[model samples]
Target: MIRSYEKTDLEEMVRIWYEASVIAHFFIPASFWASQKSTMKEKYLPLAENFIFEEEGQISGFISLVGEHVCALFIAPEMQGRGIGRALLEHAKTLKGKLSLKVYKENERAFHFYKKCGFVAASEEVDEYTGCVQILMEWEQVR
Candidate 1:
């Protein structure tokens, strides 16, 4: 089931984010992800429109959106490949209809996954904070 993110979900959500980030963003240092955990919990997640995917009484995945921009999407490492990310993204789609996000150019799985989900890469730029090239992707519901 998809549900709104609540205060109680912070810890688990950060756990999922950190674990997935390490695996998917191997180009970045693991320490960088560790340093961002608290910020993700205290700052980013609280500031976004977050959705939690819970099943069998556990949160399997989640997505965070700030307006039409998707800020984050992650699934537990053990729980990946089961379409949870797509499910969470679809829930966001139903809410916003049109969505946008930036993906690290090196994260091929994510870039292709977003493409498979109908997002098209519109442009690319270097992220000042990470010194990594990012692709700006957008998806809109067909009218």
Candidate 2:
């Protein structure tokens, strides 16, 4: 049920973003979510492409990428731990090049999830707006 994103998916995407951001705040702040929307749309969305996972015709999760760099991946809280995230990461792997992304250092679940999906921690840096340390990860396929 993976497909390209459409404008109609915005509301659901926003909801998912909010939910994920709240979960992210154990290491940051909720207000960073509000502050980042314009930048996310103007900077991130244009550089990124999105894919939605549908079940029985409803979107249950999504992953967005900027070229080979994943900008976001989220599954509804109720829908998590059911392999949706892994499936999306596996789908990303089938794309034609190396893939990369950043995850909050304190979000251990996400850090481990990406690791399990074959990404390796390549770097770390502080996020300017949220002041949270983030780890940059990458996965590359040998030719």
Candidate 3:
């Protein structure tokens, strides 16, 4: 069930982040995981107002949002492809305005996921940390 993040869930959340990063290493470097963790905490976490996802009563996966931008959406290695991410994205659409997110170009799974969810590629740029080209996608809810 999806709900707001609690202070107690930080550890589990970080674990999910690490696991997701490791999975991403198939296309990027393992070392990038450390930098990604730091960025997630420093740049995204603080701005995030809500973090929610399905938990097996044990905090397995999570989705965090900063305003209308999806700052993070991660599922534990053992629990992905179970509709958690899609549900989170759909929930985010109920918020106030257009939603936007930056995804690494190499992470084609996510790029296509966002595209499948009706987000259009709005821009492209290089990421400073991994030196990977990144795509910025956005979904607007017409009034």
Across 1-143, the per-residue lDDT of candidate 2 in tens digits comes to: 88888878877776777787787556567776878776765666556788888899888888998788898998887788889888888888888479999998999989998898888999999988677899999999878
- Evaluated against the true structure, the overall lDDT of model 1 is 0.96
Residue 88's lDDT within candidate 3 is 77
Best by lDDT: 1
Q: What TM-score would you give candidate 1 relative to the actual structure?
A: 0.98
Candidate 3, residue 117: lDDT: 92
Query: Which lDDT values do the candidates have, in the order given?
Result: 0.96, 0.83, 0.79
Report the candidate with higher lDDT, 2 versus 3. Answer: 2
At residue 15, what lDDT does model 2 achieve? 76
Report the C-alpha lDDT of model 3 over 1-143, residue by residue, as the tens digit.
87888767776787788888788646777777866676666566656876568566877677777677777888888878888888877877876478989898888898998999999999999988778898999999877
Which stretch of 10 consecutive residues in model 1 shows the poorest summed lDDT?
125-134
Candidate 3 lowest-lDDT run of ten:
38-47
Clashes of each: 0, 0, 0
Identify the runs in model 3 with alpha carbons over 4 angstroms from their true place. Answer: 35-43
Candidate 1: tens digits of C-alpha lDDT, residues 85-116: 99998899999989999999999999999999
Candidate 2's error at 86, in angstroms?
0.8
In Å, residue 115's CA in model 2 sits off its true spot by 0.8
